[model samples]
Target: MPSLPPLLAKPVDLAPLWLVERLARLILSSVLKAHPDLFERLGDYRQTRYRFSPADLPLHFIVVPETRQLTVSRGHPPVADAAMTGPLVLLLGLLEGRCDADALFFSRDLSVTGDMEAMLALRNALDDSAIDLPSTLGTLAGPFSALVAGAARSIRSRALAERHATWN
Candidate 1:
């Protein structure tokens, strides 16, 4: 999958941290609301701190499931029990179970560090979630949901086309 061009990502790097964090939290809250059980599978691992670092981006995202909290960081990403570093697209695909976590890790397209057990637990939870990211994001558009979804799906297809086809 293609990474966001450095030029395109520059604005995000320059944006205020609070703004980015707020937007991310909004999306996270929406997803949580849509699938309340999304993290239930994690059970005991739900309290673990996870960091998602997009290799193409300048900052990383921190998520605390038990607290239902999300934060963004530029210089400091905060402590995490586990961290996954990869392109934003691949990460999002994994969240929706549209990407095979094992394949990505084995192929070196993704990297996981810190607590392997916690990372695997998170993967298992995601695999069982049956999440549809475009649909979830589209709902944020309200009346334009269908249009937004179509565009998102189109973009997603394009992003996944050059790489693996298996949506594991």
Candidate 2:
């Protein structure tokens, strides 16, 4: 496949942020509805702002725990209480609890900045919860939930495989 020039690639890369942002908000809303105590577990950090950056993509997401809002954009904010950065696969793996946080951090595949404590707390909370993105998103699909979940898993697997292939 021919690579897109930088000028063209910029917009192409940014396009997904819009779709991702909308989907993220919907998923978050469903998650909050299912788990009302999500914010309560966040404690003082409930009000803290967290930024998630996907290193391979031109995208960032600022999440406000208190408001239960997640804003996806093309760049990081001026400031964030805590920021976690990694490739999209690593981020998804962490989210799905399929990857070991400690191993990723130690291996430098993932990074955290600003409020370490808040990040740790967030990590702990995530660890305690059963967050299956595909299943979660499937729930929103109602009757087609299983099919949606299966497609999501398939897409994720293919993306991960492609990413791994590039590393070799």
Candidate 3:
């Protein structure tokens, strides 16, 4: 099989912005539905926009706290209350609790700009929840839960491995 990065690069780069945005919205809504606590915790940032930029990708997402929406776009928004920038792997690691946020921030692996309070609140809320993306996705997959979970885990592992290989 082709390595993950090379296989994904072309398709992801070629995908239309509208398609990406719609997919992101669907995924975000599903995740939020599976974990209502996450939405509740984000209530403090109601009506605010939190942008997430995966430094290595030509994409970014704006997360709306009030509506629990995630909109993917090609460029960073002109104005956002808070923005988190990093490689996708690092961001996923932070979300999965696989690494420490402070360490990553101190080491400059990840960065947060704009509202510090909002960022901290988000970090805290994520840490407080037991969010396993693959598991959540599996549950959302209904009867195909196991298959979905397996595929998610496989993809995650490949992505992480690719990142590690590049670093080393």
Candidate 4:
């Protein structure tokens, strides 16, 4: 059998908006559940929406840490909170907790704007719970290894489905 590529490892290419939205939602859902209090800090943003866009080689995540919550369509500045310029694969690696968040910044593999305060809130909220890939994999896996396999299949499926859909 051919070896599987690293999870989320990728070359530069335009991503399907739906897939990107899905991934962002998944991450936020997990984050919110883990750190409900984190959202509370956003004075009025308890019900705000945010967007992530990858411009250039790095992924730019723009968001307001406060409660006013800025989104792609309704934000004033309409710029990213912090620009994370680096390998997309590495960002995925970091997200999987395969790499330490601090270390990534130190190594310059990732960057952030609201990271200082935003990360503090994130860490405070999610420092305890970790992603239990074993369970996630058991719930959604084929014959291949769980983590990488499941994720790859999920991404591929979403990509194909999105491609087949007619926007009209």
Q: Stretches of candidate 2 above 4 Å error?
A: 1-18, 76-78, 157-168
Best by TM-score: 1
lDDT on C-alpha atoms for all candidate structures: 0.83, 0.75, 0.73, 0.42
Please identify which of the two predictions, 3 or 4, would achieve the higher lDDT against the true structure: 3
Model 1 segments more than 4 A misplaced:
5-11
Per-residue CA lDDT of model 2 for 1-168, tens digit only, reads: 112235534665857767778877898888877777866888999998999887766778888999887998875454789999887766766665566778778777788899999988888777667677888879999999999999877766665565352221
Q: What CA root-mean-square deviation does each model show from the true structure?
A: 1.8, 5.3, 4.2, 11.0
Please tell me which model should have the higher TM-score, number 1 or number 4: 1
lDDT of model 4 at position 150: 65
Clashes of 1: 0
lDDT score, residue 89, model 3?
64
Tens-digit lDDT track of model 4 for 1-168: 011133343432355545554554555555545545555654444333333333223344444544423332212334443334344444433334444566556755455554355454443333344543333443444455566556654654353243232211
For every model shown, the clashing-pair count is: 0, 0, 0, 5
- State the number of backbone clashes in model 3: 0
Question: Which 10 successive residues of model 2 have the least lDDT summed?
Answer: 1-10
> Judged by lDDT, which candidate is best?
1
lDDT of model 2 at residue 66? 91
Clashing residue pairs in candidate 4 are: 42-67, 43-67, 44-67, 45-67, 62-81
After superposition of all CA atoms, the RMSD between model 2 and the true structure is 5.3
